[model samples]
Structures are given as C-alpha cells and as structure tokens.
Target: MKTYFRLLSFAKPIEKFAIPYVILTLLAVVFNTLQLALLAPLLTTLFASGSANATILTKPAGWADVTGYLNYFSQQISFTYGPFGALKFVCGVIVIAVILGNVFRYFAQRIMEDFRIHTLLNLRKSVFNNVMDQHVGYFSNQRKGDIIAKIASDVGAVQFSVTGTLQVVFKEPLQLTAYVFMLFSISFKLTIFALLVIPISAFVISKIVKRLKEQATMAQHMFGLMISYLDEALSGIKIIKSFNATEAIKDKFDSENVRYSDLGRKMARRQQLSGPVSESLSVAMVTTIVLYGGSLILNHQSDLTGPEFVTYIALFSRIMQPAKALTNSFSGIHTGLAAGERVLELIDQKPEITDAPDAVSITSFNHSIRLENLSFSYPGRTVLKDINLTIPKGKTIALVGPSGGGKSTLMDLIPRFTEVESGRVTIDGTDVRKLKMESLWSLIGVVNQESMLFNDTIFNNIAFGLPDATQEQVEHAARIANAHDFILQTEHGYQSNIGDRGMKLSGGQKQRICIARAVLKNPPIMMLDEATSALDTESEKLVQEALNNLMKNRTSLVIAHRLSTIQSADMIVVLEDGQINEQGTHLELLQRNGLYKRLIDMQTFND
Candidate 1:
C-alpha cells in the first residue's frame, strides 16, 4: 500500500483532474449501489401481499428507510402520481440515476486516460532528454536493447499503474464501502458477523501478495532481458549466420524464453488464486449470514418481518461481488507498484555530466587549444599521463600510434567525454569545463569509422545535424562528399528511406552520407577518428578524398591507424604508453630513425 501511494505521487502533475474524477466516481458509486438496493423494495412489496401498485405513503411496510429517502428525492425532482406512483417513480429514478452514473463515469475515465498518457509521455521524454545530455561514456557501458526497454516497456508499465490501478483503486473501494454501509444500516448485528470474515481473508491474501509482488518484479526484469537478447540477435543476424551459430543462438534464446515464460506463469498462477480465494471466502460469509439472520427472524428478536428479511438478504448478497472485486484490485495495485518501481529507478538516475551554473556559450574561437599536463584514468588503470600538447588555430594535427596507446583517449579529452584527473583542456582561452556543453559541441564535428544513420530518408540523414538546412544545401553537401550521385540513382533519390542504421546501403555509401552530414554542419573544428579504416581500397580512396575536401580549411585533429593516411600531415604526434614519444612531420619523423620510423618500416614490410 505504501508502495502504491509512492507510485501515485508520480501523477502529481495531473492532480488538477483528481477532484473532478473523484466526484464523478462518487456519483457512479452512489447510483450503482442504488440500482442494487432498489431490488429490495420491489421484492418487499410483492412478498408482503400488498397491491403491486402500492404508493410510498400507503405502504410504509414495503419502503426501507434508504428507499424512502430515494423516493422523496425522486418525487421532489420530477413528476409523482398518488397510491400507484411508487413503482413508476422507483423505476424512473433507477433509469435516470443509471444514465447519470454512466455519463459521469465516461467523462471521468476520459480525464484519467488523458492524464495517464500525458504523464507517461512527459516521463518518457524526460528520460530520453536526460540520456541525451549524458557524456558519451554513459552509453558505451550500456546495451542498446536495455535502454530501449527502459523507454518503451518500463515507461508503459508506469502508465498502467497510473490509469488501470487508479480505476480499481477509486471505483471498487467506493462501491464496496457503499454496499457495506447499507448492510450495516439494515441489520447491524448480522453485518458485524459478515464483516468478521474480511480481515481474516485479507490477512491470507496479504501473505500471497507479498510473494506475488516479488515474482512480478522478477518477471518484468526477465522480460527486459528477453527483449535485449532478441535485439542483439537480430542486429547480429548476418554475423551469426556467417559463423553458423544459429542453433547455438537459438538455444540461448529458447532458454531465456522458457525462463521468462515460467516466471510469467508463476505470476499468473498467483493472480488467478486471488479471485477464487476471495470469492470462496465471500460465499462462506454469506452462507453464515443467511443462517444466522434467518434464526433472528424466526425468533422475532429483530424488528424485520419476512419480506424485510428477504430484502436484507438480497442486499447483503450484493456486497460479495464488490468485496471480491476489491480484493482482485488490491492484487493488481501490488503488481503495478512493482512495475512502477522499475521505471522510477531509471528516472531517478543522476547523469555523470551536466551544464554548470556559471557555464557560458562561446560564439567564436580566436586562440589555440591547450592540453596542460593532462592525466586521465579509467576504473583502476591510468590511460593518459602528463600529456602536454598545443593545437594552434587553423592548423591540422594528427595522432598516430599503435592500438591501446591512448591516441583515441587524447581526442576524447577535448570533448570531456572522460574527465581529466590532474589537468585541464582549454578551447581558445577558456577552460572547456567552464563553457556550456552545447556551445562547445556546436563548434566541433566528429566522423567516426562506422557511420550511424537512422531509419529515415537520405535527405533527412544528411540534414540530421542541421535540421533547418534547405534541400539545396543538403544536396550541395552530398555532392561535395560524393554521395549525391548514388543517392540520385536510388529509387526515390534523396527522398528514399534508408533502412535501420542505413543497413540497406553499402559501407562506402553510408560513410559518404555520414561525411555529407558532417559537411553540412560546417563546424570550426573536426575530429576524424580512423574514419577510413573500415573501407576497401577503392572506397577508402573515395572517402579519404571526401574527408580531405571537408578538412581543407578546418582545424582538424585526426587519429589514424593506417600510416599511409597521415604521411602528408602537417604535424604528427606519436603516442606510446599514454605519453608522447615523437613529434614531427612524416618525413622528419622517418629521418629521426625512432619509434615513428619503426612504425613506417613495419607498415612498409606489411605492404
């Protein structure tokens, strides 16, 4: 119950609708109770041997106190006849009350539905926006499917908690309470005996609910894992087929599927038990009440007559249905609370990086970029140490080194993807940490070895970074990157939709499209990290040409694994074991006969 209340707090923003919804719910509860309670009068009159058309004043014996109150309200509001008016009046009141109940219920449900969808939509947007603001390293450690599950499945669970649980919580309890109160008014001693079973049944239900909640939480987590497995397997289908690991992957998936199914079945079994257990207990209590109340009528110790006893029994039976429903709803609330906890866990996570209060935007770059004795470590090991370098404005600097020599880490530092432990990175004259992240990133463009494209049209992909770019500007940028020719040859040309991650296009084509996107941005600085390493010789030539065109006048920082690519670089910085080992032009480094010369010789030998 505490967990449910906590989950409900997430809907606080939609609290303005709560009052109206509660009012309508109360009205529905009243009318629904009246509809059931109306049966008592018709039964009483027919059983009492009075004229079927007896009026309210002429037949005080037939009219229960509650029924008389209802009759008075109905006659005051509308038409009323004399002795035979009660029947018509009761029937008419029931019809109008039912209509009003349903109408209020309809509007109340609409308000709740809208509020639930709106609140969940806002929560999803907030989670996505927070993820986008995080440093790149945050995603590097996360699975794509897991993140997607958090956004889609987990957030959806919260919506169910808000809307579905709210319906049961508000409606069922009000109905149950109204019925119980009516029972109390008719026969207090009998109602007391009937009420005794409630707490005992509730205690048993509570024990089952504790276990059910634990299983439900486990089931949702397993579902997430299953989704992630399917996502991973589908994304790597080509690789799996090439490796002939289909059966193995299938076996793994089947195992996970079985576990997920078994857990779900267990949860279902627990939930299924709740309904029957509640119903069975309710039947026992109703039977006991009939026997006990029948004895009272026979002994003439109660004020009620034969017809009144029958009416009371009929009204008391109505309580069981709603009582049963309340128990079922309680179980649902428990499961929903478990699901909401998962979603709120993600929403509560604090991002590793964010804009500072004093952060300001930098509109232009006038000075050089400086790395002052920078040092960085990951987890337990240092990756960069005492690395000092100066990148002058309007000049190109290339980082060339063996794998794991911290060349990529050096480029990562410029963007503060991983914070430095002992030094600072300054862009122009201001520390990058002091500048607003948006302004810092706005000035830089990065082109990685693998191009990332969404499932959208070619034009949209090229214009991704610059959303407001005109068609002509996109086309011109595509032309500059050598992507225009192939795009035009496609079925819809630039308007053609690319498949997921641009999987429909060849590697070279995707790379060219990525280059066009970077070209469209036209940032002041560029980071080319092994940008042509994945291409074949011919594609490499084309991409390298496009890259050269893009980097012509920009302050470019290139990290290259292939020695040939950086042969004509203006300056090359050689890194080995987290520190600079050599710095010179290609020919100048080769003349030094050191680490750079050794690397060139090794490449020459491989060729």
Candidate 2:
C-alpha cells in the first residue's frame, strides 16, 4: 500500500480529475440503477391488461417509499389512461434513463482517461530525469539494459496498473455502495443473507494473490536481465560474430527468454483465474437469493410482491460488476507496484560526488589545476596513492607508463568525476569539490579512447552542448581539427547524418570529429585519454595532428599508449603502481635512464 501511494504522488493535483469524475459517476450509477428499478413498474403496470379499476395517485416521496409508490402509481396509470397509456409511460421512462445514464458514464470516462494520461506523463518524466542525473561510476556498477528497462518497460507497466488502480479504488466502491443501498431498500433481511458473497470473493482472491507481489518482483528483474542480454548482443554484434559465439549468444538469450515466458505464463494463470472465481461466487449468491426469496413470496411470509422480488434479484446480481473489477485490477496493480519499487529505488539513489552547499560557479579557467596529497581507491584496490601533480596553464603534460598505472584515474579526479578519499584537488586554490560540477566541467574538454557521437548530423554532433553555435563557428572548429574537408565530402556536408557512434566514418575521421566537438567548446583545459591509441599508423598521424591543434595555448593532460606521441611534451610524468615514479622533460627523462627511458627505448625498438 505504501509503494502504491508513493507512485500516486506523481499524479499531483489529482482533484482536478477526481472531483468531476465523482460527480458524473454518481449520476451514471443512479440512473443506471433506475434502469433496473423501473423494470418492476414496467411489468406490474403494463402486464396487467384487464385491470379496469386502476386509479391515479401521488408520486413517491422518498427512497424508502419508492417500492410501494411505484406499485400504487402503476395501478393508477392503468385506470386513468388505459393499459396502453401505462405501457407508453413506463417504456418512455426506461428509454430516458438509458440515455441519461450513458451520457454521465461517457463524461466520467473522459475525465478518467485524462487522469491516466497525465499520471503516466509525470511518472515517466520523474524516472528519466533521475536516471540522467546519476554519477559516471553508477553506470559501471549497473547494467545498461536494466536502466533502459526501468525507464521504458517498467514505466509503461506502471501507467496501466497504478493509474488503473486509481479508478477502481475511487469509482468502484461508490458504485458498490449504491447497489448495496438499493438492494437493502428492497428487502433488508434478504440483503443481509446475500452479503455472504462479499467476504467469499475477498477471501478467495486474497489467497490467490498472496504471493503475487514476490513473483512480480522476480519477473521484473528477469525481464531486465533479458533486456541486458539483448543490449549486449546488439552493441557487440561485431565481436560476437568474430568470435563465432552466435550459437552461444543465442543460447544465453533464449534461456532467459524461456524463463521469463514461463513465469509470465504462471502469472497469467493466476491473473486469469481471479475473474472466473469471483463471477462464480456472484452466480452462487444469486442462486441462493432466488431460492430463499422465492420461498418467502410463495409462503406469504415476505412483503415483496412478484415484481418487487424480480427487481431485487436484478440489482443484486450485477453488484459483482464492481467487485469483479476490483479483484481483476488487483492482479495488474500488484505487478505495477512491484515495478514502482524498482523505479523508486533508482530515483532515491544519491550521487556520491556532489558539490558543497556553498559551492561557487567558476566562469573561467586561470592558473593551474593542482593535486595536493591526493589519494584514491576502489573496493579492495588502491588506484592512486599520495599523488601530487600540477597541470600549469598553456603547457602540455603527458602521462606515460605501463598499463594499470592509474593514468586515467588521475585524469578523472581533475573534473571530480570520481571523488578522492584523501587530500584535495584545487583549481586556482579553490577546492574542486567546492565548485559546481557544471562550472568545473565547462572549462575542461575531454576526448576519450572511444569516439562517442550520437546518431545525428555532423553539425549537431560538433555543436552538441553549444546548441546556439553558428554554422561559420562549427566549420571553423572542424577546420582547426582538420575535419572540414572530410565532412564536406560526405553526402550532405555538415548536415549529413552520422550513424550511431559515428559508424559512418573511418577511425581517423571519427577522432577528428571528436576533436572538432572539443574545439567548438573551446575550453581552457584539455584531457586526451589515448585519443590516438585505436587508430592505424596513417589514421594515427591525422588524429595526432588534430590533437595538437586542439591543445594549442591550453592546459593539457595527455595519456598516450604510444610513447612517441609525447616526446615533445613540456613535462613527462611516469606513473607506476598508483604513485608518480618520475617527472621530467622527455629529454631529461631519457637522460635519467629510468622508467621513462626504458619505456621510450622499448617503444623506439618496436617502431
């Protein structure tokens, strides 16, 4: 119940829809019941064809006297205008009741439909916004497919289930109350006997649904795993095919698929079973009422006339309509609330890296980014320890070392992508943690090992965050990255659509585009993480030149897998095993004949 209410909070200001819906629904129910209640008058008045002594009388004063008044007026109408007149009067009343009843019902549905759509909109937006705000480390700890599933499939299920429960909770009970009231007004004793149907349906449904929430949680989780598998297969289609793991991938996915399907089948059986069980109980209740009410009328022991007994049976039988709806929607509501728990769990997660309350926004970069007594770790592993370094303005600092030496980890600390365990990183003497993330990141440009591009036009990709960038500015940035010529050669020039992750471009071309994106941003600090590592010799030269152009007159932190790319760097920092082993000019380092010399010598021999 708590989970369900939390989900409903997304549908704020719900009274806008609720108040109008209640008013119309009440009218619909009243007239609809009248449709059944009028059956008695229709039969008793029109069917008595030869009652020539019928006379007119006063109308019914209140609900308690409606049964007697109806009978009295039926005889009165028969005598006043003839049997034909009473037939016309009763038939006309039933027709008008049907029209007015449906009119109110239609408007009520319109209001409820708006509420459903509005609730879905708010819930989906909240889920997606929270997902986007998570820290970079959060993605590594979770599956991409599961995140996608929560935002897409789970939110969709919530829309149907949670909002549907709203209608059932509000409208159904009022409808049931109206039905019960009319049944009792007809015969208090028989209504009491028929009330057994309520508890029977409630108990049976309770037992059937006892474990539905647990099963639903399992199903949602399994579905996420299946989607994760699908995402992996699609993203790594090239690798899967190259390794000849087609059959292997198929088996892995199909195994989960079969499991999800089987669980779905089981859930369906339980969900499908509720309807029949409740309906059968309703039928049994009606049968009991008939046998019991019939005996009373037959033995002259009850006040209900033949026509009144028929009306009572009609009203009592359909009492199950709302009860059946309440039971059946429970199956869906249970599934939705389970999905809601998962979604809320994600939204409630607080990012470990956040600026202090007094954080100020830095509009420009000046001086150097300094690491003072900095140290960091992961679970059970130290990545960087006692690291102190400085990246001065307008100077290129290259990081070169053997793999697993913490070069990338050091780079991540500059922008506070990962928090430090000890010491501080200060930008111009103000701690980075005390600066708003947007302000710090705005001054830093990053081009990673993998070229990340959206499926969009080259112009848009280059000007991604700078949405208002002019065409001339984007082309100038592209030219600086040596990409203007290649971009124009494409089918649509700057406006040409680059397929997913720039798959339409070669490795060199893609790197140049990434550089162009950085150049357009024109940040004062640049971090190039092996930006040329994945390219061939020819492509590497093109991308290396683009990197040189992007780093001009900027503070640069370069991590290169290929040692030759950083020989001209102003200072070379050699990291080994989470600590800085050496720092010097490339020539000075080679003269030291230390780790830097050995690394350069080995790379020189390979070249």
Candidate 3:
C-alpha cells in the first residue's frame, strides 16, 4: 500500500481529474441504475397485468416509499394518457435513460483516459530522471536492460493497472451499492438473501487470488531477466558468432524465454480463473434466491407481485456483474502493486553523488587539481590507496599502469562521477564536493576508449548537450581534430546520420570524431583514457595527431597503454596494486630504471 501510494503521488494535482471524474461517474451510475429500476414500473404500467382497471392513483407522500410512488405514477400515467400513451412514455424514458447513461459513461471514460496519459507522463519522467542522476557505480552494479525494462515495460503495466483500478475502485462500488439499494426497496427479505453472497464470494475469490501478488512480482522479475538476456545477445552478437557460441547464446536466451513464458502462462491461468470462479459463485447465489423466492410466492406468503418479483430477480442478477468486476479489480491491483513496487524502488533510490547544499559553480580553470590523502574502494577491495597527486594547469601528465591499477577510477574522481571514498579532490583550492557537479564537469573534456556516440547526425553528435552549438563551431572543432576532411567526404558530411555508436565510421574515423567532440567542448581540463591505443598504425597516427591538437596547452591527465605515446609527458605516474609506484618527467623515469622504465622496456620489446 505504501509503495502504491508513493507511485500514485507522481500523479500530481490529481484532484483536477479526480473531481470531474467523480461527478461524471456518479451521474453515470445514477442513470444506469434508474434505467434498470424503471423496468418494473414500466412493465406494471404498460402490461396492466394486475391493475388493468385499478383506481386512478395519487402521488405517494414520501421519497422513502419508492415502489409505492412508482406504482402510483404508473397508474396515474395509464389512466390519464391511456395505456398506449403510457407505453410510449415508458419506452421513451428507457431510451433516454440508456442514452444519458452511455453519454455520461463516455465522458467519464475520456477523462480517465486523459488521467492515465497524465500519470504515465509524470511517472516515466520521474523514473528516467532519477536513473540519469545516479552515480557511475550504480550502473556498474545494475544491468542496463533491467533498468530499461523497469522504466519502459514495468512502468507501462503499472500505468494501466493503477488507472484501471482507480476507475474500478470508485465506479464499481457505487454501481453495486445502487443495485443493492434498488433490490432492498423492492423486497427487503430477498435483498438479505442476496447480500449473504458478498462475503462468501469475497472469501472464495480471496483464496483464488491470495498468491497473485507474489506471482505477479515473480512475473515482473522474469520479464526483466529475459529483457537483460535479449539485450546481451543483441549487443554481443559479433562476439557470439566469432567465438562460435551462437547456439550457446541462443539456448541461454531460450531458457529464460521458456521460464518467462511458463510463468506468464501460470499468471494468466490464475488471472483468467478469477473471473469465471466469481461469476459461478454469483450464479449459484442467484439460483438459490430464485428457488427461495419462488417458494414464498407459491405459498402466498409475500406481497411481491408477479412483475415486482421478476424485477427483483433482474436487479439481483445484475448485482453479480459489479461484484464480479470488483473481484477482478482486486486481481488487477495485485499485478499493478507488484509492478509499482519495482518502479518505487527506482524512485526511492537516492543518488550517491550529488552537489552540496551550498555548493558554488566554478567559472574558469586557473590552477591545479590536487588529490590529497586520497583513497578509493569498492566493497571489500581497495582500488586506490593513500594516493596523493597534483595536475598543474597547462601541463600534460600521463598515468602509465598495469590493468586494475585504478587509472580510470582516478579520472572518474575528478569529474565527481564517483564520490570520494575518503579524500578531498580540490580544483584550484575549492573541494570538488563543494562545487556544483554541472560546473565541475563543464570544465573537463573526456574521450574514452569506447566512442559513446548517439544515433544521430555527425553534427548533432558532436554538439551533444550543447544544443546551441553552431555548425561553424562544430566544423572548426572537427578540423582541429583532423576529422573534417573525412567527414566532408562522407554521404552527408556533418549532416550524415552516424549509425548507433558511430558504427558507420571506421575505427580511426570514430576516434577522430570523438576527438572533434572533445575539441568542440574545448574544456580547460582533459582526461584522455588511451583514446589512441585501440586503433591500427594508420588510424593511430591520425588519432594521435588529433589528441595532440586537443591536449595542446590544456591541463591533461592521460592513461596510456603504449609507452611511446607518453614519452613526452610532463609527468608520468606509475601505479601498481592501488599505490603510486613512481612519478616524474618521462625522461627522469627512464633514467631511474624503475617501474616506468620496466614498462617502457617491455612495450619496446613487444614492438
């Protein structure tokens, strides 16, 4: 219930929809019940079954005497307007009742539809926004596809379940109560017999759907797992084929598919079974009412006339429809609540990385960024321990290290992508934590090993997050990164759509385009994570030139795999097993014959 209410809160200003929906639905319910209630009086008035020559009746004195007033008015209409005139009037009334009932129902449906869309918009936006704000470590521990499933499919299910439940919750009960009132007005004894079904039906239906919430929760998780499998299969298709593991991958996905399908089948069985089981119980109760009421009529023990008895049976049978609907709604709410819990889990998540309450935004980069008494860890294992370093303004410093040496982790700390576990990373003199993340990230340009390009045009990709960047500015940056000539030679040049992650471009082409993007941002501080290490010799030379252009006179920290690339770096820090092993100018490290020298010697030997 708490999770449901939290998800519901996303539907803000709900009263706007609530107020009008209540009015329309209530009116709809009234007309619907009135339409059915008129059936009895209309029969008595038109057929003249018992009261063909009955006395010309007067209006009843009170509203509480519904049947008395109905009979009186029917007789009055019959005597004054003739039987045929009364017949026409009853027919016209039934038609009007139905039309008005349908009209109000339509308007209510329209409002609920709008309400559904509005809730979907707000809920999806909140979930996606919270996801985008999480720390880098969060994604590392989560499956991208699971997150996508929660945001897309889970939220979609929750929307329908919630809105449908809201529609049913308000509308169904009023309808049931209205029917019950009419039945009691006609025959209080019969109404009591019919009312007993409420609890019995509720108990039986409760047993059927008792485990629905748990099943629904499992169904949602299975869906997420299947989606994750699908995503991995699609993203790693090339690897699967190259490794000759296509069958293995297919079987893996097929297994999850089977599990999800089986679970869905089971859930569907339970859900579909509820409606029938409830309906059967309702029919059984209706049968019992008929037998008992017929005995009373035969024994001449009741005042219910033939027409009124028929009307009572009609109203009693109709009661089951709403009762059945309410039980079905309970089933739907279970599915919705299950999905809602997953969505709330996401919404309830607080970002581990966020700016301070009084954090200031930096405008310019002037001095150095220092890491003081720095240490970083991830649950039971330390990545960087007691590391202290300074990157001076306008100097190119390279970090050369073996795998798992925390090079990327160190770079991430600068942009506040991950929180500082124990140390202070200060820009100029202000702690990075004491500055707004937007301002901190704005001053740094990053180019990673993987070219993170969106599925958009070249110009748009280059100008991403800088919506106001002009073509002239983009082309200039491309030129500086040595990407302009190749770009213009393409199908649409800067206007050309780069396929997903720039798949249309060659390795060197993609790398240069990435460099162009960094150049376009043109931040004062740059973090280059072996941006040139993945390319062939020809692409390497081209990308290296672009990287040089991007790094010129900028405060740069680089992680280099190839020893030659950082031979000219102002300082090269060597890290081994989460500690700084060496730091100095490139030549000084070579002269020392230490870890840096050993790395350079090994790379040279491999070359």
Best by TM-score: 3
Q: For residues 1-607, could you state the per-residue lDDT of candidate 2 as single tens digits? A: 8888888888888899989999998999888878887888887775467555533446666767666666677668777887788888888988999999999999999998898889889988888888777778778899999988898888888888888888888778888988888888788888888886579878998788777888898999999999999999998999999999999999999999999999998998898888888888889888989999999999998988777888999988888998889888887888999999998887788877777899999998778889999999999999898999988889999998999999998999889888889999999999999999999999999999999999999999999979999999999999999999999999999999999989999989999999999999999999999999999999898889989999999999999999889988999999999999999998899889999899878988988
lDDT (C-alpha) at residue 51 in model 2: 56
Residue pairs whose backbone atoms clash in candidate 2: 55-76
Q: Write the per-residue lDDT of candidate 3 for residues 507-559, one digit (tens) a residue.
A: 89988888888998889999999898889999999899899989998999999
Query: How do the candidates rank by TM-score, highest first?
Result: 3, 2, 1
Q: Rank by lDDT, descending?
A: 2, 3, 1
What would the per-residue lDDT of candidate 1 be over residues 1-607, giving only the tens digit for each residue? 6655655665666568788888888988888777766665545434433555534433235444675454344434333444245566667767887898888889889888877877677778877877777788888887767677778886787677545777776777788888877776577787787787678778877766667767768877877788888998998999999999999999998998999899888878888898888778777777887888888888887876564567577777777776666677667766666777776666677777776789999887777899999998888887889998998877789998888889888898787776678888999878888988888888899999879999999999999999999999999999889889999999999999989999989889999999999999998899999999999999899898999889988888999888898777788999998999999898899899999999888989998
Can you list the residue pairs that collide in candidate 3?
Answer: none
Clashing pairs in 1: none
TM-score of each: 0.93, 0.97, 0.97
Candidate 1: C-alpha RMSD to true structure equals 3.0
List all candidate RMSDs to the true structure: 3.0, 1.7, 1.5
Instruction: Point out the higher-scoring one by lDDT: 1 or 2.
Output: 2
Candidate 1, after superposition: displacement of residue 366 in Å?
1.9
Q: In model 1, which runs have C-alpha deviations exceeding 4 angstroms?
A: 1-6, 48-64, 68-85
